[model samples]
Target: MMALVGPVGPVGIDQLGVYVPEYVLPLDQLAAARGVPVEKLHIGIGAQQMAVAPPWEDAVTLGANAAARAIAQGHISPDEIGLLLVATETGVDHAKPASIFLHELLGVTANCRTLELKHACYSGTAGVMIAADWIRSGAARGRKALVVATDIARYDLHSSAEFTQGAGAVAVVVSEQPRLLALDPISGVFASNVYDFWRPLDRREALVDGKFSVDCYLNALDGAVADYRNGHSTPSGALSEEFAALLYHTPFPKMAYKAHLRLIEGEWRAAGRNPADLGPAAEQSYRTLVEPTLGAARVVGNTYTASLYLCLAWLAEQQGRALEGRSLGLFSYGSGCCAEFFSGQCVAGSAKVAAGIGVADLLAARRTLTVDEYEAFGRDGAGADLPVESRANFCRFAGVREDKRLYERTGSLAQ
Candidate 1:
């Protein structure tokens, strides 16, 4: 348990921007390609569609685009950001941090301290906490921080985890007097060395122990939630009823569903109620408090570090003004493995800021790829050599050549 020491001034997300690639793979198409029933993916796993990044998009490009959107939408001058951190598992360079490229592409001040954070998926939340603390502790001297979570979840073809692959990025601006959710200073974190999921340096895709991963995720959720309750001095009964919404990292929607069941069951058990008898009540509570948070993950699949923030973005956009002053509980988990439980209060007008990000339109405008096309794209690195028209106002991965990664900025530089 770690709590802010100084007078915690209001510091939280001031703006959020998301960039989902322009390609999508429908779960039905994937099911047919894998010779499996569509219901397995559609209902069992709860994945509807997934975003696919073209060759021109990687973690760096996605992060840069997302950060650009955040800066533009928030009307934040690049010079105002003193720290820029990127969280990712699929970084472009092994030696150079992804934030270095993003810093140049976004045109942040040269004086900014930029780095990459990695802890599987939990790195994003870690970056958020670091930024908030930096501001709260006066290290930032009123300057803001930019934290971007960007990743492309890739799995070996025909692997069990294939259907869960997706790509996207979310950029959040943190500063005092946040327009979005105001974060609490205290957070509950639990970490353990677990090998449920991982990728070695030589492997291009992840290797996962599916069953063990699920168990780890659930156990981490339970532990973090318990720590959170104990730290806040709130008993299980009150903890369950206090939150207006609960958000969690969604590798797939079904995982989140199971976690919600655990949470509801635990609460009931603590209150001396029969968990079996509260089935209908639990379902209703999940539908009301948890289901809404999965909307984006259902469509975009697992975005690694961006997973939870994407859910928060979706909630903010969908719930809009109605979420004002409501308390939101968030659980973040990363493989090999760390988990944190935290809470935030939705500020007034936060919904409008979320809605302004235009994530829905971005998803709607995507081009769907057939199974064969998708496989071919994956085979040739998504046509990395093919020439594509460059948008005038976007950041893109130009290409890699001679073992050097190149990035291009065609848009107006951040001021």
Candidate 2:
């Protein structure tokens, strides 16, 4: 079916805000507490740090922070946001959209259609694309929409997935003629494979055939990129070797590395040349952009769908370098399998993008516990589900007791 390709609608992200909890968790500390080899937490995975949010800050608070920060940075107004879409896997309620929480907590206008989208990590892009289409439809009429990606990943204690778990949120406002990064509508996606990964509600961690996941990712990546490149007759093909940078979802540092390598290998083979003969050019590009981005990912553990979005955020924050006015190829892969290959044109607004929280501050904020302590900390079970306290960070369910949750700021206001 031919979807409406609009009247040159210039839709893109207007502003971006980030929310990270004040707490930090050091992998070295985790090793110290677990009695595991320090290298396992260090060089092996190369993870130096992670963010740990208090029970009070769930997906909603994290999302709110990003949204508020975007506003604080002077981008859009609450009145301009006609739609609120929260794309997250770790939702507070299945029946109700978590977007409602942000709307109520932030006191968004009543007319906004608050909703949540779930499709693994692709949900964020889904939200953005939908907003883009809305703008293309002329339905926005200058109004904007809020798209938030917030997640808390926990893979149980001592599980493979555990090392990749991270908590944070990325909020972006989408509108017509954004001054920041301009998103190109051209995208390639692949659906219909469920064998790679999953985490059911009954289970706390995910079950992933690491190798299988990698294969699925590579296949989707190549197919989507090739199709897009072939369909559009652009210079050197978007999937060709020339682009500003390539960014990926770093579930575990090595995971994306393998996929990146596979891309190069396939490219060499397609040209009917020995991969070794391609020299360091191809390898270097992937190594420079893909590697460090994945390395930074190690500290985060896995954010399920939010992982790739954070990788992009991390890239935009690094200083003294230049990426403005360049095109970045992005591969966003989600388990239970969904993937997207798209490109984002980096504009001149990185000064704003840099304002987001950095790796150093986030890692520094965490409070480490012994592995036993971590197990105990996680086991603590949202801390005393009391109903009378006021919690400043207020989690999704259960009010604060005595100033903890029961006493949280209510929308009705006090008498």
Candidate 3:
């Protein structure tokens, strides 16, 4: 990993775009199907709905769609992108990097550097940091880099993680003069070798030590935040006073809320203040600074590598004009595990860029699926019985043939 030093100028997100699949599985339906109370899913798990990709949709299609949207929204020519990095855990191929497919799909220049990154959910933030460093180092002078986080979170049927399963992608364009959040080059990271979550090579879904995973998540957050504050000489109240919002890599909203509480209590204790005395105030601050960032993730569930960026897009879209000049604290974590605490300041006119992405419209336009329908969709992995031909105009995963993964692209370039 490259060292993170302060950049000479603002270098961060120039444009952003997100793609959630058209299908949605409501939590109420999931609870009903699982023979549980609706509140168990809605309140207990902190997920309201989950975005579900069809048999024909996977990381590649979702990523390509998001990248295309970012390129179009930024008015960036494909040839102007010098680096294309994809962060994903649910890659379609074991040996081939997903960014190679994305590069060809998006029509990026032949000279572009392309690769895929994996560190569980933290890979996306890693991609963003690397792209920013690449530009700041003047290696890609005058050219923009595309960083994408795409994933599908899946577990075995009727499992605790089932409610958290979701699929989506977020694409960001990075350049010197950013239209969205301008990143601080200095970041704090904490990594440890722990197996809270993992998937064996032969398994299709992840095996998680649920309680252990939660513990690791909170511990990682504490370590990262402490390191960040100490490295920067930040005071205890800096988190509560300086940052307008706090975003987390959410597997679910309730987990993020717990992490926020831990952060607040940690800050108070480190400052020699009684955490018990600050309970009500801390809760209020968490609601104010963190709740807004969860709106989208609550609806989309856990998107693995895409989770943190999804929170960022949600915050940008929800706060809009009010976000200008305000700083944001972001926490990125991957299970096995790596965590980073970083900050970014919203540049002027960031609201315009956020509004251009049309996330609200996309969510509104999604098709809600009944529990039976969702189950059926999940079972039909090969998409042989479905009318995939109707989706030919868009990028889709055509069924595998002769043990080879196939993709269909009707148009020359993604619209």
The candidate that wins on lDDT is: 1
lDDT of 3 at 281: 89
User: Looking at model 3, which ten-residue stretch has the lowest summed lDDT?
Assistant: 385-394
Q: Please, what is the TM-score per model?
A: 0.96, 0.85, 0.95
Q: Name the TM-score of candidate 3.
A: 0.95
Model 1, TM vs. native: 0.96
> How many pairs in model 2 have backbone atoms within 3 A of each other, for residues 3 or more apart or on separate chains, i.e. clashes?
25
lDDT of each: 0.88, 0.68, 0.86
Query: Could you give candidate 3's per-residue lDDT for residues 56-93 as a string of tens digits?
Result: 78889889888877887778899999999999998988
The Cα RMSD in angstroms, rounded to one decimal, for candidate 1 relative to the true structure is 3.0
| Clashing pairs in model 3, backbone N/Cα/C closer than 3 A | none
Task: Give the per-residue lDDT of model 1 (tens digit) for 46-162.
Answer: 999988877777899888888988888888899899999999999977889999998888777899999999999999999999999899887787789999999999998898899
Runs off by more than 4 Å, candidate 1? 1-8, 390-393, 413-415
Candidate 2 wrongly placed segments (more than 4 Å): 1-9, 32-36, 40-44, 234-240, 276-279, 292-296, 319-321, 349-373, 383-415
Query: Which candidate has the highest TM-score of all?
Result: 1
